[model samples]
Target: MLTIHVVSHTHWDREWYLTFQQFRFRLVELIDQLLALLDADPDYRYFMLDGQAIVLEDYLEVRPERKEDVRRYAQEGRLLIGPWYILPDEFLVSPEATVRNLLIGERVCRRFGPKMRIGYLPDPFGHIGQMPQILRGFDIDAACLWRGVGEAPTELRWRAPDGSEVLLLHLRDSYSNAAWLPADENGFVQGLAELRDSLAPYATTSHVLAMQGTDHTRPRADLPRLLAAADARLEDTRVVHSTLPRYLAAVRDELGERESRLPVISGELRSSQRAHLLPGVLSTRMWIKQRNHACETLLERWAEPFSAIAAHLQPEILNLKPLVDRAWRYLLENHPHDSICGCSVDQVHREMVTRFDWCEQIGEEVTRRSLQAIVQQINATTPAIVVFNPSSSPRTDLVSVEIEPPPEPDQPLLDEAGRIVPYRTLGRRRREFFGMEVDRDGFAFLVAQFGSTGGRVQEQLTFRHAEIAVEEGTAHVHIVVSQREGARPGPFDEALEQAQALLTDESIQHYSVRVVEDEGVTIQFVARDVPPIGYTTYTLRVGATLAVAHAVAHAVAQKPVGATLAVAHDRATLAVAHKPVGATL
Candidate 1:
C-alpha cells in the first residue's frame, strides 16, 4: 500500500500578469481567511506560506492587529514561512543576491518565530549548480523543487560543484498535484489514487509527497476532512495531512538504512524533459537585467567595501550599515522569480525602475560620504588625485581624472616619489553655471513657462547673447535655470523681456550669475601596480619632460590582459606600414 503525505500550501507570485498591488490585494484576503481557518480548525495541521517570509509583511501591512496571531501560528509550527525572502529565478540574479535573499529571509522570519529550515524552492523554473553549497551555509539539508532536471526519482541527492549535497524532493506531478480536490469522498479517493500512481514510480520509499497548492492559490479549508474521508475509501493508499518538514522526515526515516542508495543528481537543473524551462526569459526585458546588474555592482563593489573601510577608520564619524541595509532591501525586492525573470506584466517591470533608483541613490550617497570620511584622514597637503582600486588583485591600468584650472599640455603627471609618469590629455572643457532661490509655485510656473516656450530655454537664451545657467530650482533655491550653446527661433524675446522686467522689479532678489570657470582638462595615465582594494596618490608637476604624446597609430590593437611585448627570435626588425610619423609601439 502507498503512504501519501498531503502537504497543504499556496504558491504566491507577488506579481505576474497582475501588478503587485493587484495581486497583494488578493494575498491579504487569502491570509486573512487562512488565519481564521487555522484558529477554528485544530485538524488543519500545516499550511505553507509559499516558502517566503515577505508575504507576512505584505499581510500585516494591511492587518496590523493580527501580528500576534501570525506569530502564534508560525511559532506553533502551523504556518510555514520562508527559507527565502522571495522565490527568485536562480539564474537571473547574481549569486550574492541569492545569498542575501536567504540571509534577509531567515532574519525576517526569526523576528516572529522559527523559520522553515528546508530549502523550499517549489517554483523557480529551474535551479542553480551552486545551490547546494549555498544551502549548506544555512545548514539546510533538504530541497523540494519542481523543475530543471531530467528523468529522476522523487528523492535524490543533489550535489553542488563544491561537492556539497542536499536531499532533493522532486515534485513529480508538480506542486499543484492535490491543489483543488473535489468535495465528495469518491472524487477525492480517485484523485488521490491518480496522484499516488503518478508519483509511485519516482518514489524510492513508500512515503510519497502530494503538494496541495498552485500559483496564488488559497489553502483548502476542507483538505483535512477530505483526507480523513478518503482514507476510509482508498483501497491501496493511506493519505495523511503533513508539512514539508514532516514529509521529508518521513521519507528520510523510510530510507534510513538505504539513504545512500538514492539516485544522485548534480549541477544546474535546466532540463525541459518534463516541464517547460522557459529559457527565453533570460534574454527578455534586458533593461531590467541591466539595471539590476548595475545596482548590484554599485553596492557590492563600491558602496559596501568603501563604507566598511570608512567605518573601520572612523567609526565615530560614519555608520553606514543602516543605509546600506536599506539599499539591499530595496534591491532584493526586484529579484523575485517573475519580476527578475522579465515575464511579469509591464506595470510590474515599470515599478521595478523606482526601486532600482532608490537602491542606486542610497548606494551613491553612502559611497560619497564614505569616501569623504576616508579622505579626511589622509595627510596629503598638495592637490593630488586619489585612485582607488576596488579589485582584489594588483592592477596596472590607465586611469583618468579631470583637473580644474586646466593642467598645462606640457606638464607631466607625477607619482608619489616625484617620478615622471606618462600621460595624455584627452579633452578640455570650460564649465559655467548660475544659482538662485525660488518657491514651489514659482518653480512650477517656470517649468510651465519653459515648456510653453518650446522646452528650449537654453537655446533661446544662447541666441540672445545672455545664456541662462540654471535649468530648474528647488524649494530653498527658486528660479534656478541654466542653458547651453544652442540657437533656435522661439519666445527668446518674450523671455528676455520678462527677465528685464524681473531685474527691475523689487520682488526678485539674489539674481546673480555665479560663474564657475571650471576649465578642467581630462588627463589619462597608467597607474602602475595599484594595491589591491586600496588607493594610490598622483599629482601633476609643473616642469618635467613630457613622456606622453597623443599620436594616432595605424596599427591594429590587440586585446591583452596587461602590457604585452613581442620579441624577435633572430634580430628581426619590426615594420609598420602606413603609420603616422613619430608613432611607436
Candidate 2:
C-alpha cells in the first residue's frame, strides 16, 4: 500500500527593510522556535524555510554555523523549495519578474543541494495567463495554489489560452483554511478524516496531507496532535513529512503516468473557458493601456527637468539607474490585472486609481530632467506638438490643444507663411483660435499665433481624412460613417429588419435581439424560460460595418447574428469591429 505523504510549508511575507529590526527579530525568533521543535521530534520533522528571504544575507553571514546546518539539511532534502527572493505580489508582477524570482530561488536551493522541480505559490491573489509559460521555462514540473477556486472541479489540469497541459492538484477548501487556523485537534482530525473519506470514492493509492507552517500569529496547536492522531488511524495511510519534489515523484510513480509536456504554476487556469482559447488575445492589453497612459503623463511633466539634471551632472546620478529599473519592473508586473485588485470591483477600481497616481508622480520626476536635454538640443528648430487619443475606436474630429503663450500682450505671432491668423476673444484679456478637425485616428496639424500675456493659449482642432481635400485657406472636414459594403439603402434599417426576422423564427423563441446603433446589438436569452434539455438556434444578418460589442451564451447560440460575424457559440465575450488604417483596434 502507498503511504500518505504530508507536506507542510511556511509562507513568510517578507517586509525586510521596511520593518527593519522588528522584522529581523520576528524571523529569527520564529526560526529558533521552529528548529527547537523539529529537533525534539524524532518521528516527525519540520520542513522550515523563509518565503523570499533573499534580503536576509546580512543576518545569515553573521551566523555561519547555523547557515551550514541549514545547507546540510537542504542537502538531505529536509528543506522544501521556494523562490530565491520574495515576489512583491504575484498578480502585480510581470511574467519576467516571476521567472526571475523562480530562477533565483532555484539557484539558491542548488547552492545547498539538488534542483527543485515543483513551484510553490500558496496564495497568489489571482492568476495571470502568461505564468504557465514562465514556469515551463524554469523546468518546474508542478505547483500549488489555493485562492482561485470558488467551486471545486473533479480533477485538476494545467490550462492556458494555447492549450498547454500541466498536472494540477488543488488544495481542498476545508483543509486549506483549517491547516492554517485549526480550531482544535478534534476539528483538525475531522477535516483530515473527511478528506480521506472523499478520496476513498476515487482510485487513489497514495495521497499528500499538505499543511502550512505553525508559526505566525495564527494559533495552530492542533497540528502536532493531528499528526499523532493520523499516525494511529488508517492502515494504508502513513503520515510522512514531504516536499513538493518528493510528493510529485511518488504520485507520478504510483499513477504510472509519464511526465506532462506542459509547464505548471500556482494559479487558476484560464483555458477552461473557450473565450480565452481564441487567437491574438494577449493577456497584457489592460496592463498596456495603464502603462502607456502612465508613461505619457510622466513624459509630459518631467522630461525637461530630468534632461537638464543629467546634462549638468553627467555620471553623478548613475546609481539611481537601478532604482529606475526596479520601478519599471514593478510597474510591468502589476500593470496587468489592475482591474481585479481588492475584494470587489469597486475596491479594485479604487486601488487602480491610487496606483495610477503613484505612477504619475514617478513619471513626472523622471521625465522632467530627460526633456530638458531634448529641448536644449532641439532649440534651433520649430517644436512640433503631437497629440494622441488612445481608444478602441475613433473620436469626434474636434479636440482641444492648450499651449503657453508669450509674456508680452502685443507680441506678434507668425504662421508658417508669416501671416497673422485671426483669433476669437475668449475672456477680457485672453484670446482663442480654432485648428483643423482631427479624424478618428486623432491626428491633426495646426499653426499657433504669437501673443502677449504669455499665460496659456487654448484652441479646438477638427480632424478629417486627408483624401477629402479642404478648399484653399478654409478648413472643410468630411465625416465618414461606417456602413456595410453591399447593404441597400440604410444599413441600420437592414440590421433592424434582420433582428425582426429572428423574433419571428420558431427555432429561436428563447432568444431576442434589439439593434441599437451606438451599443451595437443587444441579445437576451432566458434558459430557464425554455425547455431544460433542448438546444435552439437563431440567425440574423448585420451590416458588415456593425460589430459585436458584447455577448454571452450557454449551450446554444443566444444570438444567431453572431454567426454572420464568424463568432462561435462557445465564446463568452467577443469584440468584433473594423479598424482604420495605422490605428490600434
Candidate 3:
C-alpha cells in the first residue's frame, strides 16, 4: 500500500507590529486548534511552521508543552520536522541570509525531533543563480518551490548551476488557488484527475503529487472535505501525499547508482508577465542606490570634521557597526517579495522609498552628532573644519569651512609660539575622487599644518585631484598627483596607454575630431556629473593639436554632451557639434 503523508504549514508574516502578549496568544490558539484536528486521525500526523513565524512568535516559554505533544507524535513515527521556518520571499534575501536562516531552522527542528533533510521555499518569486548549491550544502536533499516554474517539466532532477544533484518537485500553479477559500472543489478534483491522466504514460516511474498552502488563514471547513474527495479520485492511480523528504528518499531508492544530472528550467509563473510581479527586484535595487547616495552625500559634507574627531576621540562614539548590522536585518525583513507578487510599481515605490528615507534620516542624524563631537575635540589639537554634503549627487564647487576653538579656556591650549592660539586654516582638498577625468562630488579631508620652530613645518596633506597631460604629437602621457607624492608615474602612464589603445580599437567612431564653425564657433566644455549617484564631473577640453584633437574627439564622443573645445588654427575658434552630419545636416 502507498503511504500517504498529510503536511500542513502555518505561516505568519514576521514584521507585524504585535505585542509579546498578542504573539503568545496567537501561537497558543493556532497550536491548540491544529492539535485538536490532528488528534482525529493516525494517518494525518504532520504540521510544518514557517521559520520566520516561529522566531517572531517567541514560543520559547510554551515550547516545552508543545515539545511533549510533538514527541508523542514522533514516537509513533508520524511527526516529521520540516524547514525550521518558512522564509518569505527567498529571492530578495541574500544567499548568505537564506543559508543562515536554513541553518537556524535546522537547529530549531533538531531540538524538537530529527533534523529535516527536505528544503521548502514556497514563496521565492524566482530562483537565483546560487540557491541549489546552498541548499545542498545544508544537506537538504530536496526542495519544493512554486514560483518561477512556469510551464516547465515538473519531474525530480538536479537543477543547480554548479552541477550538484538534488530532487526538485515543482508545485502546480493551478493548485495554488485551492489553498484559499472560494476555490472550486469540483474544479480542483478535476484538475487532479486531469494530472493523473497526463502522467499515465510515465506510470513506469514514481511520481509525486505536491500541494502547498497556508494553514493559518485557510478555511478549515473546506480543507478536509477537499482532501477526502481528491484522495478518493486519485486512489485508483498511484497517488501518495508525501512531504519533500519522503519523496526524495523514494527517488534515491529507485535511482540508486545512477546519474541524476538534469537541465535547469525556468519555473516562473507565466501569468506574472505583468510588470507588477517584478517591482520588488527593481525597487530593492533603487532603494540601495538611493540610500547609498544619501549616506555618501552626508559623509562627503562632514568627512573632514568626522574623520578628525574620530581620529582623536574614543572609537566607541563613532561606532557605526551596530547601525550597519541593523540595516542588513531591516533589508532582510522588508524584502519586496514579502509584500505581494505582481504588486504595482507605485505601491513598491511608496513602501521602499519611505523605508529608505527613514533609514537615511537616522543614519544622517547619528553621523551628524558624532561629527560635531569630533570637531569639538580635534579643534583643540589643531585648527579643524568639517564640511557636510547631504545631496544624493557629488558636489564640485569649493565648500567653505568655519574653524572654531574649544569651549574650555582653562584647559590650557597652546599655539606654535608657546602662546595661546586661535582658529586658523588647516588646508583644503576636493571631497571626492573618480577614475575617469571627472571630479567626484563627495566629502573631502583637509588638515592645515601649523607653523613650528624649523622655519615652516611641512604638514602632510592628501588631495583628491590629479592631472594628466598628453604631450603634443606624442602618445606618451604625464600624470601629476597632488596627493601621494611618492606615487610612481610610469605605471600610471602605461595603464593610460593601454586604456587608450582599447578605446581606440573598440570605440573608434568617437576618435575623429570635427571642427564646426557656424556663425562664430562656440566650443563649450560642459562638466557633466555622473548620473543619479554621480561621484565625478568630467571636463572635456578639446585643443587644436592632432593628438589633442584625437583625444578630445574620443573623449567628447564618449562624454554625454557639453564638452569644451579649443580652436588652435588662426582662422576662427574651433566649434565641435556632438551630432554627426546626416543627409539633412
Candidate 4:
C-alpha cells in the first residue's frame, strides 16, 4: 500500500516570461483565494509559498493588511515559506553569492517565523559543485532539485566537491508533479491514481510525494474540500493533503526501513535526462558578467575586510556597513536564476543593469572611504601613490594616476625614496572629464611594484582609477609624476598583430621582469610566476640590462595575460585585457 502525500505548492517566478506587474496581478488573485481556502477549510492544513519568502515580500508591498493572516499560517507550520530568498542559478554567480542568497532568504523568512528546513529548489538550470558544502553552512541536510539529475535515481545522496553531502530528491516528473488536479471527488481520485502509478515505480519508499502546482499557478480554490472528498473515497491508501516539509518528514521516517535503498550521486549536476543546463550563460551578457566579476572581487576581496580593519583603526569615521548591506541586497535580488543567467526578457535584464550600477556605486564609495582612512595615517603633505596588491603572490604590475599639470612625457615616475621607475606605457589621456578639479592630460600612470603579492596585499607605492580624494578635495598636490604618450602601434587588435610578429623572431631560454628600485630606472634579470590570481605587474626601465629588455618585449607579445613590456628595436608592445574565451587566467 502507498500513501500519497498531496503536497500543495506554487512555483513563483517573480519576474520572468512576463514582467513583475503582470505576474503580480495573478499573484494578488492567487494569494487572496489561497488565504480564503486556508482560513475557511479546517482540513486545509498545508500550502507551500513557492519555496521562496520573497513572494510574501512582493505580496506585502501591495497588500499590507494580510500580514497577520500570513504570520498565523506560517507560524502554525501550515504554510511553508522560504528555504530560499529566491531560487538562484547556481553557476551564474560566485560561491560567496550562493551563500549570501541563502543567507538573505533565511534572514527574511525568520523575521516572520521559522523557515522550511528543506533546500527546496523547484527550478534552476543547474546546481553548482559546492552547493552541498554551502547548504551545510545553513544546516540544510536535504534538497529537491529537478535539472541535472541525468540518469541518477530520483532519490540519492548527493555530495559536494568539499565532501559535504545532502540527501537529495530529483523530481523525475518535474515540479508540476500533480498540477491541475481536478477539484472534484471523482476527477481527483483519478488524478491520484495516475499520480501514484507515475510515482510508484520511482518511489524509493512507501511514501509517494508529489508537487501540486506549477509556475504561477493559481491556488486551488476548492483544494481542501476536494482533498477531503478524495480521502473519503480512496481506500487502498490514506490520501492526505500535506505540506512539503510534513511529507518529507514522513518520507524520512519511512526511509528508516530496511528495504529502502537510495542511490548516491556526487559532484555538479550540469545535465539531466531531458534538459541540458545551458552552458552558454557563462558568457551571455558578457559586459554585465565582467562588471559582476570585478564588483564581486573588489567588495569581497578588498572592500569588506579593509573596511573592517579600518573601522578598528578609525571606528568613528568609517562605519560603512549600512551602505555595504544596501548594495549587497540589490545584488542578491538580481541573482535569481533567470535574471543573472541573462536568459530573461528584456525588461528583467534592464532592471538588472540598474542594480549593477548601484552595486558599483556602493563598491566605489565604500572602497574609497575605507582606503582613504588607512591612507590618511600614512602621509598628507607629500604626494604619494598607494599600490594595493589583492593577490597573495608577488609580481610587478602597472599602476596609473592623474594629477594637475602632469609630468613631462619622458620624465620617469619616482617612488618615496626618489627612484626613476622604468615604465614602457604610452597613450596619453587628456579627458574632457576631470575629477577633483584636475584637468585632462593631467593623468600619469606608472609601474608600482617588483615582486610584491600581486596587488592583493596593499603595496602603497602608486595608483589610479575612478575619482577618489586621499586628502581634502580640489587641493593642489605636488609629486614628480611620469607622463607617458608615445604610441603609433594602432588599436589593440592591430598592436597585438605587430607584437605577435616581433615575438616570432624572438626566442629566449628563460626571462623575467625583475622589480628593481634604483634612484633612476634600474632593470634586473630575474623571473618568477605571477600571483595565483590577479593582474601580473611587470616593470621596464630605460638603460635596463640587455636580458631584461629582450625578455620584457618577448613576454608582452604573447597570447595570455595582457603584457606591457619595453622590447628591442625601440618597438612599444601593448596588449589590453586579453582573456581568451574561457581561459582561467
- Model 1, 18-130: lDDT tens digits are 99899999999999999989989999888999889999999899999999999999999999999899889989889998999999999989988888989999788799999
lDDT of 4: 0.65
Q: Of 3 and 4, which scores higher on lDDT?
A: 4
Candidate 2 stretches greater than 4 Å from native: 11-28, 38-77, 84-117, 149-155, 174-194, 200-205, 212-233, 258-321, 328-585
Candidate 1 lDDT for residue 36: 87
RMSD of each: 13.4, 21.4, 19.0, 14.5
Error of 1 at 74 (Å): 0.5
lDDT of each: 0.78, 0.41, 0.44, 0.65
138, model 3: CA deviation in Å?
A: 1.6
Q: What stretches of model 1 exceed 4 Å from their correct place? A: 408-410, 431-518, 541-585
**Model 3 per-residue lDDT tens digits across residues 1-585:** 332233455555433344334545677666666666668754454555543434422554665557677656544434455454446455444455566466555655666666556666665556664666777898776766666665544555545667665666665443232344334777766765655555434322355443434624421434556667677766654444445566566656755654254434523232343112454454544555455345434433343234444545766556654554344344333442443222334444345555555555655665666656644554333342333343456543333232221111112212222322112223332222222221111100000111121111122322212233333322221222233343222233333344345334432222111111111111112122322222221111112134434554566678846544446464332334434321000
Top TM-score prediction, candidate number: 1
> Any runs in candidate 3 off by more than 4 Å, and if so which?
1-6, 10-29, 39-41, 50-91, 156-158, 174-195, 198-204, 212-235, 238-241, 257-281, 284-330, 340-585
Q: Please, what are the lDDT tens digits per residue for candidate 2 over residues 151-181?
A: 4432255665666545555554422433443
Alpha-carbon TM-score of each model against the true structure: 0.79, 0.46, 0.47, 0.71
lDDT digits (tens) for residues 251-278 of candidate 4: 7887875323567678888775656677
**Best of the two (1, 4) by lDDT:** 1
Q: Which candidate number maximizes lDDT?
A: 1
List the lowest-lDDT window of 10 residues for candidate 4.
509-518
